[model samples]
Target: MTAGVETQASAKVSAPSASRVRVEAAAPRPNMGWIVPTLYILFLMLPIYWLVNMSFKTNTEITGTFSLWPQNPTLRNYIVIFTDPAWYSGYINSIIYVVMNTVISVAVALPAAYAFSRYRFLGDKHLFFWLLTNRMAPPAVFALPFFQLYSAFGLIDTHIAVALAHCLFNVPLAVWILEGFMSGVPKEIDETAYIDGYSFPRFFARIFVPLIASGIGVAAFFCFMFSWVELLIARTLTTTAAKPIAATMTRTVSASGMDWGVLAAAGVLTIIPGALVIYFVRNYIAKGFALGRV
Candidate 1:
């Protein structure tokens, strides 16, 4: 009887364990989880690939041939851009204004963001809303005003003009982003710095800035991209000297029809700056998105 009872207990324990093992073994593992991401990447890459392919083909081949790759690849389009002063200068002008805008926007936003995150005052909410409202208005609405304003200041056809104009939108966005990141940091850090006989500017530069470095990166990245790609305001604000690569591309449409190959090459070149910016700040952007800290 004793032996039989022991056998029964062992059987009972082993039965459930064996069943659990079987159930686990029968359970379906994740089936090709990489498929969706792979498909997504391919979808995103297809247009870029087509654009690159088109860049290598002549206008005739581009319009006539339909292929996954260029049938008769040529360097003429890229050569045209590299050799032409107007074409190359447009790229330089774009880089200048974009850099200027990013600097000004981030510099102004840092102090303003610190204020918003650390203090409370009358109309603070209203003030913040007002700043964001500037961002809310369409660029078209501001285009004429910016043109007139820059005209008044003799700032037209200048890189600084475009940079300052872009600040109208970018400053508010930078503030909003930086404020969120600043708020995530503890007030105790500020207080402790004060206790240690650190001056306001010193503490801000040395400690607070590093703490919110990712936010700055994210803000600067956005500012650079917006200033780089924005055509309407940049076009409205400049006619020739400061005209961006985007504006120059529009001129490719001539009496002989569009220079599709050259245009494709220009478009591909335009993507480079934004791609580089993303590569550098990708970590910051990822962290910001994940934690809502930036």
Candidate 2:
């Protein structure tokens, strides 16, 4: 009787096991998860790939043919960009102002953000909202006003003019970003530093800054991008001496028609600075995003 009972229990267990196996076998398999993302990436890459292809080909070939790849590869487009004063100087001017804007924005924001995060002041919330309002306003709204103001100061057509104008937007954004990161840090840190007889500047530079380095990187990255790609303000404030590559690309017309090859080459070159910035700050930006600190 005990043996028969044991056999019955074994049979019950085996029955479910067999049923589960059969169900799994009959279930439809899922399709590949990567297909959609892969196709989307390829779609986005098409324009950039086409741009690079055109950059390598001569204007005649570019206009006459619609090849996926360059038929007659030539470096003449790149050569002109590198050698020509107008072409290369735009790159230089852009880099100068971008660097300046990044530095100034981050520098100003660090102190302001620290203040906002650490201490309460009169109209602090109102002040913070006002700062955001500046960022929200379009660049075009400020462009003409900036142009006129800079003109009065004889600052138009100068790299500093663009850099400083960019600060009007960048500083507020930097402050907002840095404030969020700073607030995440414990107030005990500041007290601890003060108890150890560390001054504000030294403590901020040595202890506090390192802790929020990711936030600074995120802020600086944004500042660099805005100053780099901005056209209207940069275009309106400068006629020639400080024209960005963005403005230069628009003026690519020649007597022979549009300098399509050189324009394409310039477009390719224009992507490099932003790419470099992204590569450097990608990790920090990722952290900022993950933590919702930005």
Candidate 3:
């Protein structure tokens, strides 16, 4: 009897129930969800890849015939950009103003955002709306006004002039973003700091700012990106001394006409700074989007 029971148990273990096998067969395979995003990414990367490919080819190869890859690759385009004073100076000028603008915008926005998040004053909403309106207005509207004003002060072609001009747009955006993050922080922390005899500045600097650091990163990123990319006003307010890379690209014509190779190389170089900024701040930006606590 014991031998019969042991043999029956072994048979049951050796063969899974027909129902279990049917259930396993019925399980759905994973859908190709990755396909759409992969295609979309490829679509976006195509132009960038083409630009890089063209940057290596000579102008003769670019226009003379269409090719996926450079038949005879050369670094002449990149060499020209690095070697030429005018070409390289444009990049320097852009960085000078962009960094200045990001710093100024975030600094100004922090105090204003703190007030908005913590205080409840008359017309606060109205004032905040007015701040956003400045950002909403097209850069073109202020281009002429800024040019005339900067000229009157003899600030044309100066880095500070461009930095200040960008602040008009950047400050409001920074303020809006920082306000949202500040609001997420509980007011109890402020009360606790005060009870410990901490001054407003001391508490803000030592305790409060650290809690909302991600917000600051997000604001600075936007400010840098805006100042780096803005063209019409940057071009209008400057000529030789403070011309940005964007304006320089527009003027990259030679006796043979547009230097396509050089332009492509410059474009590839121009994307590097913004890419680096995003890479460094990517984590902070993610935290900021989640309101730092979510």
Ranking by lDDT: 3, 1, 2
The segments of candidate 3 whose C-alpha lies over 4 angstroms from its true place after superposition are 1-29, 289-294
Model 1 / residue 133 / CA error / Å: 0.9
Measured by lDDT, the strongest candidate is 3
Please provide, for model 3 over 1-294, each residue's C-alpha lDDT reduced to its tens digit, 9 standing for 90 to 100. 557877899887775656646544444788788899999999999999999999999999999999999999999999999999899999999999999999999998999999999999999999999999999989988989998999999999999999999988999999998998898889999999999999999999999899888888888888998899899999999999999988899867888889999999999999999999999998787676554435
* lDDT tens readout by residue for model 2, 1-294: 557877899887654544335454443677687799999999999999999999999999988888989988999999999999999999999999999999999998999999999999999999999999989989978888998899999998999999999998899999988998898899999999999999989999999999998888888888898889888899999989998888999978989899899999999999998888898877777676543352
Q: Candidate 1: TM-score?
A: 0.88
RMSD of each: 10.2, 10.7, 11.8
User: For candidate 1, what is the lDDT?
Assistant: 0.90
TM-score of each: 0.88, 0.87, 0.88
lDDT per residue for candidate 1 within 1-294, as digits (tens), equals 557888999887664544335455454876888799999999999999999999999999988878888888899999999999999999999999999999999999999999999999889999999999989989989899899999999999999999999998999999998998898899999999999999999999999999988888888888887788789999999999999999999888879999999999999999998898888877777776533452
In candidate 3, how many Å is residue 246 off? 1.0
Spell out the clash pairs found in candidate 3: none
Q: Show how many residue pairs clash in every candidate, following the order shown.
A: 0, 0, 0
